[model samples]
Target: MEDSEKNIELKINQISQKLKEIRLSKGYTSYETFAFENELNRVQYWRIESGKNITLKTLLKVLEIHQISLEDFFRNL
Candidate 1:
């Protein structure tokens, strides 16, 4: 893949890992529960957690569910 693609992939992985960590730390037992709490479908939540290229709206929603702003999310990294 191109360097840009690789960078985006890495960012996606990092975001996914962060989300997983937050979910686990919050006592979520399953992705399905996480999805339900976030108002998303299980498969859609899986796709986000798997680092698939999701829409910006979906990304924002996930972060919002975690009570994180886009700026804050990246700033802490």
Candidate 2:
């Protein structure tokens, strides 16, 4: 793969890891539970945590559910 592609993949992995950590830290043992409670589309959320492509709108919904500000998310990242 090209350097740019590799970098993007690396970033996706990082984001996915962080997302998983946040859910676990919040006492969610299952991503499904988290998604249901947060009114998120379970499939889309799964994709996000799986390091697959997701829309910005969906990501914003996740942040809102977690009460995570964009600033805080980026800072943590």
Candidate 3:
């Protein structure tokens, strides 16, 4: 893969990791529980946490649910 492609993949993985960190910090042991409690699609949330491509709107919504700003979420990433 090209360097750019690799970088993109790395960033996606970071985002996924951050999301998982947030969920765990919030005391959620299961992604399904987090999604269900947030009224999000369980499969979609699972896909997101698995480093799949995500829409900016969906990302923003998820961050909001976690009470975190995009700037904060992406900080030092």
| Top of the candidates by lDDT | 3
lDDT of each: 0.84, 0.87, 0.93
lDDT of 3 by residue, 13-51 (tens): 999998999999999999999999999999999989999
Highest TM-score scorer: 3
1-77 in candidate 2: lDDT tens per residue?
Answer: 99999998988888888889999999999999999998887888899999998567877778888899878887856
Ranking by lDDT: 3, 2, 1
In model 3, the clashing pairs are none
lDDT of 1 by residue, 13-57 (tens): 988888788788889979999898767999988887888867789
Task: Evaluate residue 8 in candidate 3 and report its C-alpha lDDT on the 0 to 100 scale.
Answer: 95
Quote each prediction's TM-score: 0.84, 0.91, 0.97
**Clash pairs (backbone) in predicted model 2:** none
Judge candidate 3 at residue 6 and give its lDDT: 100
Candidate 2: global Cα-lDDT? 0.87
